[model samples]
Target: MSAATPTAPWTRTRLRTSPGTATALFLLVLLTACLAAAFPRAVDRYEDRGLRRTLAAEAPARLTVDVTVEDPGLELTPEQRTVRVSDPVTHAAYRKIAASLKAPLTADPHESSYGTRSAEPMPALDRWLPRIDGPPTQLTLNAQGGLADHARITSGRLPHGDYTARTMEAAVTRDTARHLRLAPGKVVHFPDLDGRPISVRITGVVDPVRPSGAYWSTAPLLRTPEQRSTESQPPTHYWTAALLLNPKAAAAILYTTGRAQSYWQLAPTTDTLTARQLPDVTRSLASIANGPGLLSVRTATASDTADVGSHLGDVLDRYTELRSGITPVVSVAAYGTGAVACVVLLMAGGLAADRRRAELALLRSRGASLRGIGGRLLAETAVVALPAGALGLLLALAAVPYGRVLPPVLAATAVVLLACATLPLRAMAAHRRPHPHGAA
Candidate 1:
């Protein structure tokens, strides 16, 4: 007989490769890995966008309340009263008063009521430390009980007349630095309520300070009373406040005919409330309080991206244990399912051997040994391993970005791929067929 025609070396076709089926499955795995990497960010964007939509649908609102002396013949001066009111409870009360007036209030404490706006506050400086992971709210003091002793007012200028200004070389809280808009060396003017100029020079950037309560996240070592008393001059009682500029600064602007309707119109028309507006608003609020007032504006319709991040923190804290517990269970179930599919496929391959019996007989008639047939089939299945492994590894590499956040899922997928390779091969044996006449 002529020498058996030699088969081409190492082609997938020689390996009983189901190119169409394998390609489709390979693409599916690849797509899944890609989705694993990118889907979380997409989900976050969608959530924030939806929140904006929801807020827009809600009613637009604004309100202003005066904190003037309720007591008759009050002895305290306006500045003295404002200073004494600078504590946390009084701050919350301002929000309470705004809420009572039916305003949708979100408080910000970094927006200055008085004094110059500096991006590099002591709190922002503290954030540069390596172990400081969260926001400024949790900023801790050094062993000496100083949060950031290195903090200093780098430059002071009277850019806007009579507002003694000092610029820190660091980032200030967002309420204060929001005016900076990431533009350094630019002039940001804060004016008093009477349009009197209050100058502040921007030096650097800072973190945005949000409202207190469930989402509160920043803490700086407050100046002690001794430090306050020992100072050559007393410090201004600084407070951050957000006022509604759209609904008109004062209720007097509300027309009796339709105050609520006018408020709605006012809300949308507030196209811009600059950093200058905060001083006046703070003064406005302070006029009510009789102290140095600091104020900024926040839109009821706007969704804060930082707020969404806080929500994610809540999700982790609330569901971390539950998710951790469920993850292993789900992974095991999924891996077992993949293993079962591989096992079933391999068993089915044995059934395929029966259908090919006649073909095997023809080969044997030509003097082919059972060993050769088994060797050829084994070689074909083993050939699948390289492509499969390569595909799995490529998928794993694609999973890197997502694995930064969701590592466990990506790891489980790799394990499944490895299991698929070995278990399926174990299903089939390469033993020779018995002789037709039962002769060994």
Candidate 2:
């Protein structure tokens, strides 16, 4: 057998042996590393913005509808001389109608009139928190939307019991729980309409969703004494502290005692309500409003996205974003750095072009076609860039946490670096002219 012609040293081996090629390879690795590190950080800002936008679009969370019972002239005021008696509309009737609707309707306290808007002073809520040690805060008993939707539970959970039969458990505010020296699995006593003791279990502790960080709960006593006779409402109307009652406790205190009169539109969770779902819910409410007790059932035809986000807008404020600081700055910086790095790498490629020209001319003299020559060139660079790009990737993962844009960023960077690395070979191949000795 003829001795095997010694294969020309691979293009990669020849390139690695040169000082200029080795230096260019080292510099390319570093540029790739810098890009890998910067790109992900830049991408994170946009990811944060996207998260904010998603939160803002989730507008229906704070939405509420009010179905108030107002016989404006019928109810007795505390300052009125003629003893007021006999409420024409009662909460029992509204609750019954709401129960039948089977929509997301529940009692809302803020929207319902608790004497704040009324010309007359109403009877104060009594015995709700006989144990609270400060001036009474704003409080009311709600069958549905009161506690669960308005506050986040910090510990334990919400009440679970027979809502229709007895006093259900409740979740108290963190401060209130701390004040009462209560925690999950503890019991607290509240006085009923007749001064009888009503005991409830403390199921959890919650933090209210207050605007501007204001105190979310009411005082434990009536703001002012309601000097009305037995003909009017029970003292349950004037509570200062939020005594978040479960359905059972509401039944024991409001419905069964004949004191409930208002119905509110409650959302189960902030995310539970959406604008798309609101149409059918409002339709159900409109039908239910025609029921006996509700004087005016007011619901939203459609809630605006900005209006909803204004209440609990995201930190990035992407939906209602008047201004943002993170995403734009990082984007500009990332592009600027990439452009500068490309220019520097191009210069490096130009400096190394002469050696590549002679190598390609020799390969062509041996009858290497353009396609085969290009493949050889790419393989040579890959021997350097592939390992360098991997090192750059490892550096990025170590510096920036993996998530969201990382995989895509790595992919994009690999493409760009590999593309840039081929510039010298392409430049050299295109410049190699046919010579007298048939080398091209």
- The candidate that wins on lDDT is 2
* TM-score computed on alpha carbons, candidate 2: 0.50
Q: Which run of 10 residues does model 1 get worst, by summed lDDT?
A: 256-265
Error of 2 at 370 (Å): 3.2
**Tens-digit lDDT string for candidate 1 (59-161):** 2222212122122112446444333223232333334333322112223222211110111112222222222223221111111111122223323311111
| Candidate lDDT values, in order | 0.31, 0.45
Error of 2 at 303 (Å): 18
* Residue 396 in model 2: lDDT: 64
Please provide TM-scores, in order, for all candidate models, with all chains considered together: 0.31, 0.50
How many collisions per candidate?
A: 17, 21
